[model samples]
Target: MSDEVHTEAHGQVAEPQEKLDPEVRARREAALKLVRKYGDPVLRSRALEIDRFDDALVDEVRRMGRLMHDAYGIGLAATQVGVMHRVLVYRTELEGSVAALVNPVLEWSSKDKESSEEGCLSLPGVSVEVERPVHVRVRALDERGQPILVEASGLEARVIQHEMDHLDGVLILDKTSRDQRKQAMRALREALEPRPAAA
Candidate 1:
């Protein structure tokens, strides 16, 4: 018997995750390839906030959305794609569409916390348990450069927090206990190592 408790979202009855668009798949492949694995120097620096808000910024953000989707990631930060802008993108069909938040500010969060399993596109096959606020309020600029506030709970809140952490150069490995971190890092390191071809 499974030891873990399973819910609708976490079980076989769960809704099928949305599929990535073809153009987005091609875009992600042609450009903005996800920097999978940890320890890349670019993933260690803080991201710059979006200030100019021009057509170029819009194009970058758009690419990010396609990248995130085609990479099969529910959320992605600009830093993960080798960009230093404090931009993030995420989506769920239930939420309507892919959304980008520039220079997001975590205005507030509930004191209540929950530990959940999370995986990252950048981490590639690595997952870790993370404790996070169950609810959060974030303020950010939309793709059109319009100001907006986001109130999220449950999985949505968790996804927002995870992506936002990337702006500060944080990763899922940093969110676990020491032992778990050690184990995960070892596994990640093994995955990063090139495998020998069959004889």
Candidate 2:
């Protein structure tokens, strides 16, 4: 899944409804609709390794990049879009360009850890504090199936680990403290609850 909450750290905030450009808002809404929400079985299933790196795989990566941009997310996994392929797209920064990783393997992670608040696109409105490695090394294939290695630290590392977890059917709630998990569950329940019909 992707995290859009960090956008605020870059001096960006959700615009008021009236101030939002209609086309932009529409695109964002449409992109979000493609993402599988929390409780969808696909989000809990491990993604399958992708062996074929064809034009279709390239197209999928492009589509995921567009969706991630439109949804204001830094990263997105195939599972979040109901695709069980072990693929993910991400940008190191909120305003940066996107990159794709296929069949990624976590080669190493530093022992140092740091806790940060993270939000997920699938679990909208829910934020949990998660502790993760401060540095990591990952090996994967590019969208075109070329070998690529990534060494990341801090927020970038966290984002990669978060997306990797999605590939393994794990969520931030599973990595967070019990109290935070309970709070997140409560928030999720409230969001899923149907509101009364408008008069």
For each candidate in the order shown, give its overall lDDT on alpha carbons: 0.71, 0.84
TM-score of 1: 0.82
Over 4 Å off in model 2, which ranges?
7-19
Per-residue CA lDDT of model 1 for 46-107, tens digit only, reads 99987798989889888877665455456778888789989988764322378889989999
Error of 2 at 149 (Å): 0.4
Q: Give the clashing pairs for model 1.
A: none
Clashes of each: 0, 0
Model 2 score (lDDT): 0.84
- What candidate 1 gets wrong by more than 4 Å, as runs, is 1-33, 93-96
lDDT top scorer = 2
How much RMSD separates candidate 1 from the native structure?
Answer: 5.5
Which candidate has the top score in TM-score? Answer: 2
